[model samples]
Target: MLKLAVCVSGGGTNLQAIMDAIDNGTITNARIEVVISNNKNAYALERAKKHGIQSVCISPKDYESREAFNQNFLAKLDSYQVDLVVLAGFLVVIPEAMIKSYRNRIINIHPSLIPSFCGTGYYGLKVHEGVLNRGVKVTGATVHFVDEGTDTGPIILQKAVEVKQDDTPEVLQRRVMEQAEWIIMPKAIDLIANGRVTVSDGHVRIHE
Candidate 1:
């Protein structure tokens, strides 16, 4: 089985999606080994507890430096022998050490079609807001390998959602999560777990 460790900072809707997919057999041959959060009060921890999964909180404040915090965070993953690291609403920028350690093993789901309403200062509701401001006819989600830069990784899968005429950021966020993020995230994980995902020339090629 593929052991996954999910990191989160707030509500864990995406984390819950993965858990549900695993439970329903949509994401096969995978298990969530642990859920880690930088915020001690994150609801993601509660979700993990409810499902009898191991959970940990390692706040950045507890460590002396960013590197120290990264080390401790990674140590927890190592303890679980995590094969995949899923960033589900994790707000912190991943440190370089973790990126080097995991390489293409880490993945994140961005709220908007990346390279559009993405990069620094583009997260959460901000991404939807950008889409609304730009009046894009369609906005969606992108699942990609986690690289050093913001949302600049090789794309794994993407699904587009229609941008409604009277949509607010909150409404658009919900729609994207329901129609795209939740759907593609589990599909991508399943593909990776089944050994169907391959990266070459900075691109992802999936074999079915």
Candidate 2:
């Protein structure tokens, strides 16, 4: 079975979707080994508790330095023996060492379709706001392997959501989550767990 360590920040709607998908058998041959968050009070931890899944809180503030926090986080993940690290809504920038260790084993769900409102300073509702400001009729979510650079990994799956004529960032964000993010994130995990996904030279291929 593919063991997963889901990392999140803030509320965990995406994390909930992943749990739901696993429970519903949409994502087979895998189970969540842990839910981790930088924010202690993140609702994702509570959700994990309710599901009897182990949860941990590792904040940079609690450690002496960023390097210390990164080391601890990597150690924790190694202790769990996780096969995949899922970044559901994780707000923290992944450490370089962790990225090197995990490599393409780490995956992330971005709010935007990427290459649009991604990279530095674009996250959460800010991505939706950028899409709205750009007047784009179509916006979506992307699941990709986590590389050293932000959102510059091999894309796995993307599902587009339509932008409404009179939609605020909050409304658009919600719509995108429902129509895109929630769907593709779990789907990507399912694909990876089944050994259908492969990365070659910074590109992804899905086996038939």
Candidate 3:
């Protein structure tokens, strides 16, 4: 089985989606080996525990430096022999070393259609607020490979959600997240698992 490790920093709705997909055989040949969170109280840890998957907490404050934190984090992942790393609402910027170690094996589900409302300071409700503020007619979710840059990795999948005239950031976010759970993240992981994903020339190609 292809082993996957999921990292999270929030409620982990995406994590729950992946778990549901796995339980329903949507991801046929993979196993979720572990779920790690930087915050001990993150609901994702509880979700993982409920599924009987190993859950770990590695707080950033526990380490002296970013390098040390990343080194220890990488070591923990290595122990699991993780074939893929999924960032489900994980808030921290992955260290360069960890990014180098995982390369194309790491994937992240950003809350917005990236390259637009995504960067160092954009996340969660902030991204949704940006979208609403911009008066965009449409906005949605992005699933992409993780690079050293912030949410700048090659996109694997995206789904558009129309911005209603009266939609609040919370409502818009909810709509996008619904699409993410049912479509974006699962499709991206499927592409990887089926050997249809290839990264070349700074792009991700999903073979038909």
lDDT, model 2, position 207: 99
Give candidate 3's total backbone clashes. Answer: 0
Q: Output the TM-score of candidate 2.
A: 0.99
Global lDDT of each candidate? 0.94, 0.94, 0.88
Q: What is the lDDT ranking, best to worst? A: 1, 2, 3
**Of 2 and 3, which scores higher on TM-score?**
2
Specify the highest-TM-score model's number: 2
Q: Report the Cα lDDT for residue 61, model 2.
A: 96
After superposition, candidate 3 runs with Cα above 4 Å error = none
85-186 in candidate 3: lDDT tens per residue? 999989887888888988999999888777899988898899989998999998888988999889899888888889999999999889998866467787
Candidate 2 lDDT tens digits, 98-159: 99999899999998888889999998889999999999999999999999898999999998
lDDT of 1 at 155: 99
Tens digits of lDDT, candidate 1, 29-131: 9999999999999998999999999999989899999888888877777788889999999999898888999999999999988889999999999999999
TM-score of each: 0.98, 0.99, 0.96
Q: Rank the candidates by TM-score, best first.
A: 2, 1, 3
